[model samples]
Target: MANDPTHQFLVNKIVPIEIGGIDFSFTNASLFMVASAAVASGFLYLTTSQRGIIPSRMQSVSEMSYEFIASMLREGAGSSGMKFFPMVFSLFMFILTANLLGMMPYFFTVTSQIIVTFALALFVIGTVVLYGFYKHGFGFLKLFVPHGVPGALLPLVVTIEIISFLSRPISLSVRLFANMLAGHITLKVFAGFVASLGALGALGVGGAILPLIMTVALTGLEFLVAFLQAYVFAVLTCMYLNDAIHPGSH
Candidate 1:
């Protein structure tokens, strides 16, 4: 049981709570989410609390992350999209911090849950839908209609676009959840093998070396993937916001 690859994801309630006959217990997932927010807020706030003639290391990190996310949003959503900078930045930091925190030993991977990713994706799509209709009214429907499509194929293209638009949340949720789930499971399995093999004998220990090496390599790769997935999620969010802003353009 010590090597159970899926055991790491078990959600044991830390604070049992019940209200209106529904379980409202706080769990490890909730804990890690709060931790992620605390870590990110601390990184941004505490790092910049001290003003210096030369930026400190923490300050530089905060500044770099700020500029990176800012540039990414601007590029994806155009200048007008700057209005949503706070929302986008918050999402990017939360996701990036959650992912990086998951890389820590015994820390929960918040994004690994379908419910969490699905909720985030729905929030994004919901924002896009509401803002699009609010800002552009019925004109937002034009997002399903691409420009310069032949008249005969227009309906089919529109239907395809609509399906794609509806599928956004599903795709976004599955992408992140699947990646984290698979990566962590693979890492756990390999690590388990390293331990198992090392315990057998001289030959087994020699074989364990390969698994140990793989575990180390995978650990580094997972960290890279954690950052990349966060970036991808944020980038897609910005692109969706762009569609909301310019629904009739494409």
Candidate 2:
């Protein structure tokens, strides 16, 4: 099963419980999700627990992370969007930690699951819609109408805008899910080749070197992708929130 790439994503019940008719089994994915949150929280707490004129290395890292997300929010949505800093920071840290954790051998990549990613995307868009409507009342609907479009083309443009608005969650979720899934699968395939080639005679062992090198290189690339995908998710999230903050901007 270690050789099977898809087997890594399979969710197994760690503790099974049933309530009335619904199954509430604690799964590997659930465990990893909790672990991701815990790890992120712990890191932040430990790093910033002490304050000194000259910050410790960990403290520097923690502060940098805070400023990074804060700057992103300010740039994307302006000062008004800073109110959602906690939400945005937590999202970035959780996803970043989860992606990095999954790179470890035997660790299950939670973000690779479409359902998990979709739920996150849904929460983000749901927040935007609820907050937008609450803040702007019916004025939020103005988002679908561009400022300078010709009257004849306004209806078509509005229809396109509505469709695009509706597709945000789908696009956001699939982008993260697909990148993680593809990277991990490719790594597993190359790893399998290394194992298979190394098991044979001297000639096969010699041939294994190339696949082994490729696997190592791919692992490094996957690490880069892990960070990049998290950043992309966070930035796109900020853009969406910006729309909510200023509903009628072009």
| Model 2 bad stretches (over 4 Å) | none
Q: Report the Cα lDDT for candidate 2.
A: 0.94
TM-score of each: 0.98, 0.98
lDDT score at residue 120, model 1, on the 0-100 scale = 94
Please give, for residues 186-243, the per-residue lDDT of candidate 1 as tens digits: 9999999999999999999999999999999999999999999899999999999999
Query: Could you tell me which 10 consecutive residues in candidate 2 have the lowest summed lDDT?
Result: 46-55
lDDT digits (tens) for residues 113-184 of candidate 2: 999999999999999999999999999999999899999999999999999999999999999999999999
Clashing residue pairs for model 1? none
